[model samples]
Target: METNATTNENLNMYEKAENYTKTSLELIKLKTVSATADVLSTLTSRIAVGAVVAFFTLFLNIGLSLWIGKELGEYYYGFFALAVFYLLVAVILHKTQHKLIKTPIGNMIVSSILKESKN
Candidate 1:
């Protein structure tokens, strides 16, 4: 009778541990899914907005280039001037990209993952 009672207690403990392990795994999965969804949604919205802004900037630049060319007496000259201006800007950005671009993006990803869910 004593052995039987001890065996039963051990079996109950085993069941409880199994339940705890499964529940913990499920919680981790839920957290991972929630974080991933949050990051993807934010990125999707930003990309959409970025695309719209890019189109606007492109058209504006084209118009400005034509105006500049008209003033310079040649269309290609305006484009060449704009190209040189952009080349300078690109060089500046390349020099500071780690500070201005990479760090901010990395921080944003980390913050997004660490952010607590309202639920």
Candidate 2:
């Protein structure tokens, strides 16, 4: 009888431990899902805003190029100048991309994840 009671107690303890582990795992899964959703939402918003800005920039550049062409009496020259400007900007961005963009973005993402974990 004494041995049976001891064995039953051990079984109960094991079951409780298993239950705790399962609950902890579920909580981790939920946190992962929440963090992923938050990141996706942020990225979606950024992409949408970026698309709008790009659309506006395209029209603005065309207007400016045409204006420049009118001023210079050469439409092609205006477009050429705009192209050159963009090329220079692209080069600069390529050279400084890690410093100017990637690190900041990475840090923001990490911080966001950490903040979610804290909450």
Task: Please give the TM-score that candidate 1 achieves against the real structure.
Answer: 0.93
lDDT of 2: 0.94
Poorest 10 consecutive residues by lDDT, candidate 1? 110-119
lDDT of each: 0.93, 0.94
Name the runs in model 2 displaced over 4 angstroms.
none
TM-score, one value per model: 0.93, 0.96
Question: On residues 1-119, what C-alpha lDDT tens digit does candidate 2 reach at each position?
Answer: 99999999999999999999999999999999999889889989999999999999999999999988888899977888899999999999999999999999999899888878998
Q: Please, what's the RMSD in Å of model 2?
A: 0.9
TM-score of 2: 0.96
- Backbone collision tally, model 2: 0
Candidate 1 structure quality by residue, lDDT tens digits, 20-115? 999999988898999999999999999999999999989988998999999999998888989999999999999999999999999999999888
The candidate that achieves the highest lDDT relative to the unseen native structure:
2
Residue pair clashes in candidate 1? none
